[model samples]
Target: MKFKKQIFGFMDMLRFKKLVPNRREALANGPADPLPTEYRTNVLAHRLHPGRMEVELVDAVMVTPTIRKLTFRRTDADAFPFFRAGQYVSLQSPVGDSLVSRPYSIASSPREALENKLVLGVEDAGFFSGYLCRDAKPGDRFVMSEPSGEFHYETLRDKKHIVCIAGGSGITPFVSMAKSMAEGDEPYEMTLFYGARTAQQLAFRDELDALSAKGLKVVYVLSDETCDGCEHGFVSAALMEKYVDIRESSFFLCGPQAMYDFVLKELAPYDLPRKAVRKDAGSCGNREVSDPRTFRLTVHVRDKVCEISAQENETLLTAMERAGIDAPNKCRAGGCGYCHSKWVRGEYVVADGRDGRREADRKFGFIHPCVTYPASDIELIVPVGE
Candidate 1:
């Protein structure tokens, strides 16, 4: 019995020795060559996920007043990168002393990215839109990210037909999809329900009309001025039913916050699955109404508690910026967790629809300072950026 036990022990030792070589090899490789420290930090902490991108600025003539398009081309000499349709790219720039990043959806066919070109449309909004409209020229260079967003027409998930309800600037992505359909770049039949205040504000009208002439169904739902060829009403279920068959079709909505809120109520009548409907990003409806009650916000950065005035209805990041307290933020809408911070003690209300807090972060008392407003005076721990 003792001799048998010794033989079993010897076999166990041999098996352990056989497993050690693979473990040693993995350790020697050391985590797949560790990306540059800056790149790693951005991915984990700053949300600056890096991708090999080609960046160039190309002119896109509107041929109309308020609607202009800009095209970006790949600078890579080898091959251009590809991106999914309805995805967005982050453009980073210095807004005064603070660095800011904004995400814009690609309004070109998915194949365009492979051709070293991706397009985005901007309306008359004075922020980035105004800059793109008035200042962006052919030779100008704009920084951008690889396509990012979940608002694409998926074959496995979405139905055969799609009724894209677009309003104002929200018409961008649909234009790309429509162009793709016309060019046979994508395999889906799309019916666009476009809403505008007037015919003058309707973007890509001629291009859409041409696409429709080739069998792509395009309908303009104008809110003002009943024209001969346009429907005069906001996009609702009844309106959509009049044009496209919505029984098994999906509804893709993109517009201003007020328009989306009203459209969601209008769409509530349709008992379609939750996956059948989608919306895009926009400004948080919580306007900055200054409150008289001001509290001091003590932020611990690099082991120093820097005090700043926490204004009512103002975000902590905004307060810190005003106080010359430099911090990192990419998407100020709170969707990007770049400005995530630990709230030591305080109450805050992140605007509805803008809150993208992870479940674990909520459980652990972490908050995104971009969209979080001061419900009470508080202290927080934040990371300093170089």
Candidate 2:
């Protein structure tokens, strides 16, 4: 036993000696350079998930009195990325000092994105829309994130037959999908049900007709105007039942908040599975929450706290903009997650259309201040942006 113990001690000493120089060498070498690892990982991530689609405005055309289609082309053709037909692009822009973002559905088909083009239509209202209508000109550069959103048809999840309900400018995504199907870029049968106040407000009428002539089915439901051949009424359960085969087709709804509310009640009788119904990221407006209570907002950024009064009727982003604080936001509707911020301490309420917070964020008490409102005195850790 003693002899074996001596031999073990000698072996242990040799192992210790081997470890000592390697430790010193490692210490001398210091920390490993992270750049190569980071770069390689980033490259792989880009292959898996492309990033930063910067585009330049090539042209703009007024499609209707309240609608304008802006055409953008890739600044670098070599890096242009592809997108699904019904996806959306979140745009970043500087509105005076505050940076705001808005996401518009890619009105152009996926083939267009592959061809380095993206066409989007915006209603001529609000901050970004006003900026585009009044100030945006040709050759202007627009920074957009990669195409995102999951409103497209999935073979495994969605039915081959689609019943699309659109109101106002919500027809954009369906237009893209319909065009793709008509062009044989996608294989699916679609029945589009579009609502408008009048025929004049119906955008892409000629394009829709052309696509319909090429096998896409379209039904226009006009509310205010009466035509001999067209349907004249709101898109209700009776209308849908008469026009759509609800048992075999999946439903897609895109419209204003009011329309959404009305349609939700209209659809209650269908009793379809939750997965069978989908909603577009609609407008962000608090129509039901009247007489909201105002509160104070204290934001901490870079160890500096700034106090601002927040109006109950206005969005947190709007209030911050009014206070002249540069808040980074894209897609004020809360879908893009660009305006993500940590809530240090506060009680706030995110409006309905703007409550797209992820489950992990809800667990972590993070909120998209762009769509959130101060329900009480609150402190937030916000990132300062242009």
Candidate 3:
């Protein structure tokens, strides 16, 4: 009986082995493409992380002579992605024959995005701003990337209290934060030191005043003119020390190049932790080009070759746009690495501290054209736009 049982067990094992699928046979019979799963077909995930969305300008209000508040609403999608208060969206615009993209910090709270509205406070300065302010209308269509940036406050990384230093249009992001905090979306104490030339140049004054009444500390510092109730001076370390406990707080800065230069120098004596100081990725430092001559630029995109004249002071991205070439770019500040191209030939000058390329990228002769200026006639292999 034991022998019979042993033989039966052996037979059962053999049958089980035969029923198991063979690896090679399974591979040969598998479908050529993967079938979509619930994870891949999720609607909420796609809505929250859509790469780009089509939006139309619904309203435009002039905040100041140089600043305009543009309101955008989604055209095709049901809603815009929810973004942090300090993140910015890149708006793509066609200027003449070329397409250009620029990032603007959202001035509205995250709740506003849920209502299908995004507000941008644009200051007329460069080519893109000129188009947005002068040429764009109420019904003009635009393609905007999802909100992105590393300028927002985080409870895990930042302290409970924050000191914000803003200049010019830089005050927009802080406005979003103030609104969010007032609405109970964010739980952090904020004190904003806003700098401007005069009272007339201060954008979003009324909105900020309302938020200030709701517990946001707002200090207006005027450099050129002093009001009866405003502080008269730049945002200096002395002024910051008067309001904030430097050792127990985090500092956030958003402004033009000159303001960043002066403010960072002013804060250096505090010897704060590296993580304690955060500057908006959009805050670009000043770079001077000694030469003022035009150089030849040869760009290779897929099978097409584009030749354009580049100025010594302007970036390669600017030259391509001027020539009506729609080159891809985001965070024009050089931190996003979206406009990276192969340097086929020629010399270029990358601003110091603006080179965010990886070590391997630098070693292999790749450069981000957004912040790379032509030092001489240049040749590049630019990636084709999707």
Candidate 4:
């Protein structure tokens, strides 16, 4: 045993002594080329997550009486970042004394986004949307946030078949989803139920017609007027069940509160799982107050401080935009937490069901300015705008 231990120890010593020479030899034989200046992973990361970008409006056409289809191209790059079909981007621009932005779902396919094109169907309803539909001209530039939101289909979480119920301008994301399916970029069967007040109010009819020929299922439901192919009524579960199996498919509803309430009630008897239904979170606008009170808002952005007047009914984001503060925000519905700020001191009310802050954010007094309305004078520290 002693002799065997001595031999093994000698062999180990010899192996340990050769480590330095072996390493030196390996190093000498290695390639002497300098490290790469750019890595593919980093390049891919930059491509996928550009944060924000400047975009130029290339074309604007009236898709319906109130909805305008606006096309955009990235001014900084050749193509916009490819995103999920149903995602939305917030476009911001200076409108007179105020900087305004709104989230619009992508109407074009992700493949079109890679070809230097993106599209939004903006209804002529809101302040900024009115500008886009009426006053804004081609070549006008705006800042666009990255595509985001949890409204897109997840293969693992959602069923293979999706039932998309769209109302008014809510047809935007479904249009993209249908186009994505037609383009073979996404793998899912989509059955879109587009609802409008009248057949004349339906947007994207011609495009949807062409896609229908390509095997994409589209049903036009008009409430006021009847057409040869359209079903004249609200898109209730009875109307949907006529075409597809609701039990074997997931539901995607994008529309006003009334439409959501109606559709949800219609499907309540089905007793579907929570994950089986998804809804788009539209931005929270001003609350309805009988007489809104004005309160002073002190905001700190980096080293700069500004004083703005906030209304009891309006959100902090609205106040900052009214003062041209350019506060950072993406999904202004409070779900994205992009406009999260340090609440130093304030009396505010978060919009009902709009408080989406995490436990850490709540414990640390961080508030999403987009959904918070000031009840008294407030002081906050906000991040720089994207």
Candidate 5:
């Protein structure tokens, strides 16, 4: 028994000797070189997740008096990253001394992405839109983030039939989906209830009419005017029932805040499952300030501290931007949580239906400045810029 144990111990010692050199060799030489195939796949993955891409405005067409469809072409690459039909891109441009960014739904289909082209419909609403409409030219260069949003259809979660309720410029994403369906890319039936104040305010009417040839159904709901071959009323529950069956359909809503409020109330009778409903955060409504006064704001970012004035009505994000503070932000709708900051000491009101912070974040003194309005003197610690 002693001889047998000695023999086993000797074998174990020999095995350890072999492993020691092998481990030494592995440490001396770092990781092995990746194969050419692996290198190519990694490059492709980076292209898909390229944090930001440079694009140039190739064309701009007036879709309506207030809406313009800007076509952007990739300048640095042959192809832009492919996006789901209902995704959005955040475009950044210099307004003056400060850089501003806004989210716009890609009106172009995924097929167009392969050709390095994407479309965005901008409505003349605020400062950014005003700049795009009045000052932007075809040769302008801008940086846009990769597509992001949860407004798209998922086959596992959504029904085969979808009812889209769009208002004003909110019709952009649905247009992309309709175009994708027309091209046999998406496999779902859609009925669009597009609302506008007048016939002239309805954007992409000609394109939508052409898509009807491919079996897409569109019903124009005019609120302020009655027109031939159009529904002259709001996108009420009664109107939806009169046109299609809602019980077996998934509902997708996009538009201004008022439309969202009204539509949500109207749809309450159905009591649809949460998964059956989706909304674009871009259209979340802004709140009016009861006290239209400006207050002082103290912001601490990284090692620098600055003081600025914030209006009671304007969001903290807007105040920071106007004060030339390059605060980090994306989705500006309070959904992405990118501009989340530490609310050191402040009295503020978060807009209803726009607070997307997790319960833990809310409990731990974090706030999304994009949707938070200052009611009194404020101080916050914003995350340092990348």
Candidate 6:
């Protein structure tokens, strides 16, 4: 039976009078065990987002003359955290006097990651890459950052059909994407356009073809040479129109600066919405100068401060790496903001089109060491490496 307001008020006051007594009685009768020192939620979170992992190279094969497909297994854990299909991981190892790291897209599917297997496609174009491609053998240990990147598919922001364009070693992420689609993890239909100089240079031709039979669309485009049943030209808009309506589909591009320039120029005429296109960032390399000068670089990692020599044409992150200082970095492309540090004092400049810092970060004197070069003797407070 419902009570009137005045009766409810009286009942509440009577309950309040017995509240202390009731609480004491319940406490006395409660279980004697103490509260848990750890939580289940915290344990699951740590398992999924382990920031860094120690991995061992288990296998390495030359997919092409220049690119090597390397497989790794985590030494610290039995299984790696599952990641998005198109995300990347940064691998770090000491090469000679310098401690170097580079970001490479994951070529294995996320399902394979759960089985403690992950793969990377490394092109032997740089000093560290050459070492990894040729010298690194099975059983060698390396530090691997957990899969991290914004280069994956999103259900809300992207369309159902995604047209991917790759040049040279840029086909790495699409390998994972196709595998993920075949595994029923991703919801998007993938159409890949892989462009290379010749038919033999097309890495993963057999694997991509096998996936194509499983519903993924594959197009092999050659520029210098062609074979039977392949598109014989660059990956132009005109060529794409023959198979898919690019304007109605989202685009994912990964390649060199020249390829990006060409594809972007081709799409400019369509006046497509900016969100319709997604391009993976390329790493920043040393600037070309006739005569480069070395300047003093003072770095502060926590309370320890060290001064080293930095080159005028190199980035601050490069100087830190050459000095064997473990400064935190991921993309090394000035994007991701993983290497953002405080600018203590320096005459510096961010690489063109590589500045990914927020406006508030710029206003607060934050700098991304990965893309920033020392114009003069410089000083910075770098974050401790993960």
Give the per-residue lDDT of model 4 (tens digit) for 1-386: 99999999999999999999999999999999999999999988888888898999999999899999999999998888889999999999999899998899999999998998999999999899999999988999999988888899899999999999999999999999999999998889989999999988999999999999876899999898888999989998889989999999999999988999999999999999999999998889999999899999999999998988999999999999989988999898999989999999979999999999999999999999999999999999999875
Q: List candidate 1 stretches off by more than 4 Å.
A: 1-49, 52-56, 60-64, 74-80, 136-138, 182-185, 213-215, 285-310, 317-332, 336-338, 376-386
**Model 1 per-residue lDDT tens digits across residues 244-338:** 77777887888887888887887787777899888876644244665446888889998788877887677787777666565666556777686
Clashing pairs in 5: none
> Which segments of candidate 2 are over 4 A away from where they belong?
1-50, 76-80, 286-296, 301-309, 321-331, 335-338, 352-360, 383-386
Cα RMSD for candidates in order:
6.2, 6.8, 5.4, 3.4, 4.8, 2.5
Candidate 5 TM-score versus the reference? 0.86
Best by lDDT: 4
* Residue-by-residue lDDT tens digits, candidate 5, 252-297: 9998879989999998889988888898887333467575898999
Q: Write the per-residue lDDT of candidate 2 for residues 1-386, one digit (tens) a residue.
A: 99999999999999898898989988889986654645877765674356566689889877878888888987854444566788887776667766666778888887767677788888888887878866888899877877778888888889989988899888899989998888788778999999998888888888898898888888899999998656999989899888778878888888786888888888888788899889887546443557777788887777788898887766777777667676766556787777688898877788864678889999998899878877787878887653
Off by over 4 Å in 5: 1-41, 283-286
Alpha-carbon lDDT of model 3: 0.88
- Can you give the lDDT of residue 371 in candidate 2? 80
Q: Model 3: runs farther than 4 Å from truth?
A: 1-42, 283-287
TM-score of model 6 vs. true structure: 0.94
Query: How many clashes in each structure?
Result: 1, 1, 0, 0, 0, 0
Against the hidden true structure, what lDDT does model 2 obtain? 0.80
Write the residue-wise lDDT of candidate 6 on 228-263 in tens digits.
978998989899998888878999999888999999
Question: What lDDT score goes with residue 204 in model 2?
Answer: 83
- Residue 1 CA error for candidate 3 (Å)? 36
Q: Model 4 clash tally?
A: 0
The C-alpha TM-scores of every prediction are 0.75, 0.79, 0.87, 0.93, 0.86, 0.94
